[model samples]
Target: MGRNTRKRRTPPAAKAIAAAAALALGGGGLLWANFHASAHEPDQRAWGGNQTKAATAQVATVSCPDVGQRLTNVPDAARQGVARELAALDRQITEAYARLAATRDAQAKDPGFVRNAIVGPLGEKRAATIDRIRIVVQRAGGSFDNALEQLAPCATRSANQTNAGGGQQNGDGQQNGGQQNGGQQDNGGRQGGGIGGQAGNGPVAADFVDITKVAPNVQGKPRRTANASTGTFTTRCGVNANKNHNTDNVIVAPGVTNGAHHLHDYVGNQKVDAFANNQTLLQGGTSCRNGGDLSSYYWPVVRVQDGTRDFDQNADGGGKEGNVGRILTPVQAEIKYVGSPAAKVVAMPRFLRIITGDAKTTTNGLANANAHWSCTGFENKVQLTERYPICPQGSKVVRSFAFQSCWDGRNTDSANHRTHVAFADPASGVCPNGFKAIPQLTMRLVYAVPPPVIRNGQVMNAYAVDGFPEQLHKPATDHDDFISVTRNGLANQIANCLNRGQNCA
Candidate 1:
């Protein structure tokens, strides 16, 4: 009676309302709820702010999150204002060096003149000094390629102008405007007229190699962090519960394991027979799985010290400890006083580098992928115990800016260039012993990216990353290894991933 009494006669409006309610009930509230949730929740742009702010925030929020994100382009409203200013500064620095060098060379002929010129640009010869300055100025002018590329979407295009031919001019020091010079001078002791040498160029001619000069056109910029955990599996080495923990006993046996007793893969035939009992566990034997039983699974443990503390698992009863050994995040490792750079950048001082790393293969045919991901004896953790690869002689610092380049082994064209656009954590780290930790910093390099070029009807751009370690180019067998820090191993992974699909990110 209570329910049906009012339904004696449905008004036309009431009947329509009932029909709509029936339709909605048939579908349930899922569609409406979803729509409502989506509408209520902020849109991506609203949540993330904007693209430019988002990138800068990624780096700044993590370590130096509060830092400002200056547009890669020069902030000047005037035409080529930033470029002109950069070129001029470059010329000044270059002329300073050239004048000093020329005076030093002319000492025998005119010691008095040389001495006076050292203080200030002296007479007629000031032209060459000025020319050298011009070269630097030009290089500086063209070095805004990264900034320009970043600003392209917002840039107003003119019919007569093009983005091509903006790189540092060879020999002439005057970039883009078409002055002539021998070739761009690199800081590797090779003379050149440019505002600033590449950040990752090693310190000397002996360390130089034909490195790729352009940045790649993959991602706009690099993401600071990834989900990838930096640890790999290693079998227990010989016991060294003493002062000097040498890892000659630890060999790549035949099994892979996480911190737990679970085994994932085999370690292969590469055996480390240096210890008393030489045995390789294959296919997850009971002992290999349950290493808690030392008689079954005895992994030699070593204590690596970080700062004042030791990387001790403190496993009172040890076979293998979980991932509890205080691994340093990339942020922590690179945020300290690495060291002062021998050079400066953008009027600011930078720290020196200690160890550098890259993706190139060693004599062992072990690339970064194998070193970090393979089940064989090749691994970053193991290789570090064997040797500490630092900067070669003549390199201003052990580490340099990590550049971005093409994944194709040796194919670098204008379209694809490397970039040093990442200002994430100012610090970089290396595997000192069996684990990756931050090494003490010594110096830093300041590099500028050249503007892009137009060839065959396509416009191209270039950028730079750090840690070139050009010393690897030396013919000596010792020169063939990649630097072990600054995520060179990661670089190889990046190279490998890009080779697979250029989606390594």
Candidate 2:
């Protein structure tokens, strides 16, 4: 699965190697941004002539040994070693940032600055650090398993932010504790910021940024199947009581109790869910965190109406009847995950199946006209945003919101969990805009790593996003969607840098 299996022109393995190289060599240019340096410039230190105020908040240092301790409990000694190595790598990243900041400060005061003097030493230091980390990972006995999981959350602080309760450094390069050497050396000998000797100058290296928490994205749609007969399934209420008498019968035979009614099309990718243990709430008691479902929670689907109007009691229920009372066009579902008792009960395993047709029933003043419409197409898809929760024994926890619509017409009424033709609507054609659906199912099982471990000084907790792509889904479907990645923005930026690496600072 890890072999090169891409297009004739470019192998997947090659592209992966190139990406890793770009990041490591600083060819990606992302690191330059952290130092407020331009990608086109020659040396990052050249810009450090103007020193900004040093951040004052001191970070509570999390050392490599601390992370190593966590790894000790894991049965796999090799995995533990990888964790320790990753922790050391994180430490190197932090030091690189510090070195860059120091180098830049030194050059700001001295007009005669050498670029190699600054960049060379930092690169060497970084290389040594990287080698040490690699050695540790190499010693780890088992295959690299969940190494990203342990490494993702180890946060590194930025040099720009104020240090916690420490002495100050300002934009003018003034050191509070020392004599100024034409703004060169403060008595402290700290090199930059009016401190003593000048350290080599270079742009501050970029630190790791946690990207776990983001604006909730649209998961997928759910609706009735195209083949299901409009009148075959019976509604919970009879036809006479329906506001749209003709349309109300969308739910028909077998009654709503154990009817053929099925929820349609909704789905949340379970591959991204992190693993967890439901038995305990203590930190490290379970692997699930964030929204991963260790506890019982309900995500309620609610209607958000923009305007109000009376029902079309008089219409015959066709073109005009369907337009009566302004029923929502079903843009998206709004789900509430926590603090809703009604929602929680409704989400239970059996109960969830019972109320599949819980849409509001309308009455038309006739016994046959009354019926409850199937809410299958109306509900929005919900996802456990955090790592997959550790469920208690016999606890009902949902890993994915498998909408009935996805399997409505297919033989997969049960959770076959097989990859199928996604995004094949004839109306929109194949491959939606800005997306290229790869027919091959590159299944990457992502582990959730929480923060302030991944990013330093973050006010909100974050999660580390790491996973490996799995095998392909063969004999691709006609409706296959273009596989899109929301987290590739950074990668794109890296690509931009590699294509123009020579001129980059």
Candidate 3:
């Protein structure tokens, strides 16, 4: 059960495709623009003028390199310091973005204003932080170079540059869906759309799609082998009606306050925060009906943009971070661990951490995106990733996560916190070589949300998942987190129940 004994391997494809990309870091979410590069739009310096300058060429968000994702090899000795510095880098971007918003008038007056005033200064700050990270990484016998400084230059994402999620806005101020890149809402904003629910980031008219308009998007199930593990086990965790909410991310930015910059609704283990560790969590209380299942389960809060406010409205991760509106408590939060179609699942190591979906997917691209959005009655239809589905009056909204079910059978975690676990092959249900199938944690969150109105081509009473300010509350940024703390051989019981084809709750 010791985590350190597990040998880890980063799949070759994981490396070949994951070059640094750009991300938008803004308000309450400790959204680390930790410097990611973007293949879609490289660092953009707002240039050129247009008749609809305010709504078109305006600098929309701050784009920084994803430096944190690149540091997958940081030594344990240097990891804590590196994480703090990376979080620092994220905050720096947030501050710069605030400055960018504050100086919109100045930006309008001079095309060079944002470059001179905001982006330039942010790059300097990031270079300093990146240097500190390099020092710790190198001191710990890890290889790091000044070349990472190349990622320090943050850029401005003009409105046009940011609207690539779907087709362009037409006369009706709506966007046509795109099959190549997922569709998104644009709302073809009015001039000075900089301030909305918070910072006017998005949930634009284009972001919402009528469920009836979408074609069926369900894919065939993966093929199962004769020897596959054929059972499932369920754990009943209440739908977080207890309102255990926070903006801290204990896994990604442990010990760093307000690391997520967005509020998260937590169920299962009660003692998770920016500082939670294995010891503290093991001793923590759980909300699950089963006493032995003390796993931590959480996802960003879903907020209805109805001009309402909550306790954190003035606080960091709440309204201050652009995640405003009334928080929706799901009527149901279903948690299940099911056997892999390929083989029997093994027990998860105690304290194993897993994250599904990408919180910064709006800016980070669809590479790691795993959002599944649908409506109650339309569940068999296509699930959306970028666009929020506007269910009919009788239908409700559903957000779900199918977490990686394959484990490396060694370490409980990795430097980036992802490689230790992975999803099986989409077609074959087989784990990658050297990996073992583990019970997949499939969660479904059902909410009784009122459909947003699309009157006059504008989306009203919108709903969105809390995310980094720059991510604009796009549905693609939806994610879920978990930390297994099974006690008294509960994990073995889970595996046994699953392999034997029993549904033990």
Candidate 4:
């Protein structure tokens, strides 16, 4: 197959790096929208200026079809095996992307370098991995879809968005921060002055925007009917101040190490990792104030692009994978379970897993992009999906997630990880016909980050969610995950509290 062009149609923020990670991460479709920035003229501060245009404009990232989305069903027996193969695909993209980022110099000199070296070899790896997934399903007596093979080939995305005379810049006018004066400056933990940062990956200036400039984006809330479950159950989970962090994902890639390819700050259950199963999680200690709620809540840690390093700076899932800088611990982590406005709520089944946002939204379209990004003071005024909010000095950055509340009432998990649960209709507040409405878990995380500044094109002190190297650290890739391990008694208590319109903690 030949290269296919994908033009970004989203806002000015950078596009995605990998679609594969959404398997355990998040969901959305893939459509490259060509968002060309033709305004920024030549700037001497940038490298090589017009001399570097051709190579930079033609190639930006590796875009492959999301193979995991093709599987509508997989036998429960083969789900784990299939998940492993899918994760293999995700790893392939990451390795290829890291290489592409490292070879920027060579790519500039040879236009064919990325295609012939990175994308070509990556497709071969994906093909082999896809084949293994097919075998896993077939062995479990599940029908193998031929369409899976079509996802094997991924193309290099072009970057027509680069600023003119901005050799190392991001989109027009907006610059990427890394090493500034044609040399890499070791900014303690972050490399100053380039968009490619210390690891040659993201959180570019293109990813941030002044919060006040954004229009009001709060969606209309559903009307509360008389049948609405009006009560709430709040659980106090320490903000992972205990530093429970890992790169594993138990729900999607059980038993696989480094499954998330990014470090996650964990709260509630203390023993949730790639190898932990339902039994271990149930036995695990929790950080929640309510001992009855042993549920686990986790999300990728956000990092500030400063000149310092964390312990994992040189490790595979850390700086080596383009996730650098000091991790930001949320000052506030609030967890609440509320009743649906459409109907009285039921107890959530134990071991239910739910993901709230698409970590691959930059590559995955906005269909399932539910990241609620804003500042503490302006949260009700705006909600961002594609750009990181540049909060005012007094306001802190905020990341909020409202987990899906409608359940199929049978399976606690699904092959795609999303089909088992769904969000209530935003307008009507109703579950799909056969699905039951369960108590919805909502989380709000607040972080105090230095305001990043973009001057003459370069960005400073940028912050971003840690994600797959290929996902490029775009705010659009922000997301969260959860697993309910609440005891039956506590689960019933939540339901009763909500049904009675009482708030309990």
lDDT for each candidate structure: 0.20, 0.21, 0.70, 0.70
lDDT of 3 by residue, 1-505 (tens): 0111113222322211221232221111212111212234222222101111123233344456667766667788888888899889878866665565455456666766665666666666676788788888888888885556556665554443445335322212233344332322322333333222323555565667899999898998787888788888999989998899889988889899999888999999998998889899988899999999899999999988765666776678776656777789999999999998888889888989999998765545556779999999888867998788999888889998999999999988777788889889999999999999998999999998989887664567778888877676778789999999989899999998888888788
> For candidate 3, what is the TM-score?
0.85
Q: What is the per-residue lDDT of model 4 for residues 47-90, given as tens digits with 9 covering 90 to 100?
A: 11111111122335456666666676999999999989988877
Q: What is candidate 2's CA lDDT for residue 470?
A: 6
Clash totals, every prediction: 60, 75, 27, 21
Model 4, runs deviating above 4 Å: 1-59, 104-110, 161-198
lDDT of 2 by residue, 1-505 (tens): 1222222223323332333333221110111112332234234222212122222211111111112212222223333334334334333433443344434434344422212343233333333433444455446532322332222111121333321112212212123321222211111222222211111111011111112222233443323243211111100111111121112111111112211111111112112111211112112211112222212111111111112222432322211111111232223322211111111101111101111111110000011111111112111322222222222233222212211112112221111111222233333223334322221111111112121221122111211110000000000000111111112132233223323222111
- Candidate 1 has a TM-score of 0.19
Lowest lDDT 10-residue stretch of candidate 3: 44-53
Superposition error at 197 for model 2 (Å): 28
- Please tell me which model should have the higher lDDT, number 2 or number 3: 3
- TM-score: model 2 vs. ground truth: 0.24
Best by lDDT: 3
Greater TM-score among 2 and 3 belongs to 3
Q: Using TM-score, give the best candidate's number.
A: 3
Segments in model 2 whose C-alpha atoms lie over 4 Å from true places = 1-21, 24-29, 32-75, 102-105, 109-118, 142-505
Better of 3 and 4 by lDDT: 3
